[model samples]
Target: MARRTHKGEDDGTTSNNRLELIIEAAARMFDAKGYSATSTQDIANEVGLLKGSIYYYINSKEDLLFRIIEESHEGALRAIATVSHLDVGPLAKSYALVTTHVKVFHDDRVKHSVFFKEFRSLSDNRKEIIRGTGHAYSLFLRSILEEGQQVGQVDKALNPRMATAGIVGMLNSMSFWYQDGGSWGPENIGSQFAEQVVLGLVSEEYLLSSGGRKVLLETIRGELA
Candidate 1:
């Protein structure tokens, strides 16, 4: 059975909203102060609720940390899921995924920091869950790479596993330096980042080859089919 959190409210009212607020506040606090240094009361205070009120939503500070990490993962997965279902080929899918990945992180600075940095605060079991989610997302990217290779748009010599890891590492590193205070918007940053990723992964020759086109189409069809 699927586990539901504190409130029975399915409409995202009452308990769900409170939980969202709690998670958001926790993400901010975790980003500002390292997760170990931040307390449940700090999170509760950020949300303008009593510290005891937080227990009604989560069991401990670690749970709140887990929730923040999970939110970013869910956002990332949703972005990938959307691109994975697109009618476009592997190249486009790659572009869309990169674009979404950059935009989501750049747009949600606090969650972005927690996703890349504060995940370590989770308990071993919770850390495993985050690892599983991270692995699944990497596999999803690799699947796209595999499709690209098989269809001929991507280099068959390209190792999807390493390449996927590299791409994620590159993108995630931006959190360390990306300035939300800058004049650049998320769209501009995302597009620029996506272009770099796409350029690195897709060769001009591959884009022109019949094999490349075939592989690209097949990759999308295989994923969506």
Candidate 2:
């Protein structure tokens, strides 16, 4: 049997189907045309609605931009939050981070790409909101590195904060080029990325051993201590 999202009429919010369709269309158009090149009318046409009707669901084009970026960041935050309080150490936190982050991009290619690529197109105020969300997400990633450094698990030569930003920058770029149903799905890419990052931060001995269990344990302990 088909499940129903609405059991009755007059639910405070309309069915997500309409809003989702609009967002999905906006994501594709923005990705294809660049945010500046894509207009509310374009989104409206794509979704078979009058331009004004878009306002019924969202305030304006900028509002849509905010929604897209906010939603994307929120998704990433949820993933990060999952591991934020985990009993595992920083190294394992990082592994889980990569896995979850990559999965978000793979799950919603269009929305993820917009957040990665078109966020700057938002108005200044909207950009600030997005930036705040982005900063919060970055902090979680940085904390892992900082903890790793403390534990002697990660190399002291690296700056935890800067390294976190760099790794995120690298992974965020994945959405720009990653193809769905490609040879590498989110899981494979996440695993590969996790391995690459762990190697870069941990001792060469750990890198050589493949599983890197020893180095990971050391890193976490150092961080916890």
Candidate 3:
């Protein structure tokens, strides 16, 4: 694909750094204000760049939006990729996935908030690309649920696809009510949410050891850590 940068644009770290700065500022503004309502000038002002400088890197506002959404998904996918091959039971893998998902969700709330809410603003081609990323998430989580069922770790009666949707819905909803600097940090929230997910899946065997699941969780988490 052709480069978006202008022909005479400097191929230096400074240009790259400025592009990063613009994207970061744009994410914040787009989250605060709808993408349709934000302009390149507003982004430039937010980044302390001249209005023309935005054109130096991006061809249009949607270009910036596309970059932000893709970047957030890329960050999350990379993080979760580490958990895919963990030599642990499906239940523990599910727990780790939830925590990792939530952590990545909030690692930059501004950026990811735009990701979860504003993806529809992209062009159809770009929208398909974003949807592909989303489908990967569904496959990853659904596979874990399916594996757990097969191994008797999760309830065999549960529908893996529906279970995947329920868990993902609950985690995504956190973005709506979650506040920065809340009583709990990402790790704590992730653990609590992950525990709920694990507990919901185990009704008989896991409950016998008792609801604490603390010992089990600690062992799994320690290995993961």
Q: Please provide TM-scores, in order, for all candidate models, with all chains considered together.
A: 0.81, 0.80, 0.89
Poorest lDDT segment (10 consecutive residues) of candidate 2: 3-12
Query: lDDT tens string, model 2, 3-30?
Result: 3333222243554787888888887888
User: Could you tell me the TM-score of candidate 3?
Assistant: 0.89
Off by over 4 Å in 3: 1-11, 206-214
lDDT at 149, model 2: 80
Question: TM-score winner among the candidates?
Answer: 3
RMSD of each: 6.2, 6.4, 3.3
Candidate 1 structure quality by residue, lDDT tens digits, 1-225: 865543323333577887888888888888989888888888878887777767877888888777778877887888878887798777678878887888788667788787778766667898898888788888999998889887776767778899998988988888888887688777787767666665567755775663654564455345544
Q: Report the lDDT tens digits of candidate 3 across residue range 1-225.
A: 855655435566588887888899899889989898899999988877678766888999999999999998886687569778788888889888888888888887787889878888999999999889878988988888888887777888888899889998998787687889999889899999998998888646655654457776776677787
* Stretches of candidate 2 exceeding 4 Å from the true structure: 1-16, 204-225
lDDT of 1: 0.76
Name the best candidate (by lDDT).
Answer: 3
Predictions in order: lDDT: 0.76, 0.76, 0.83
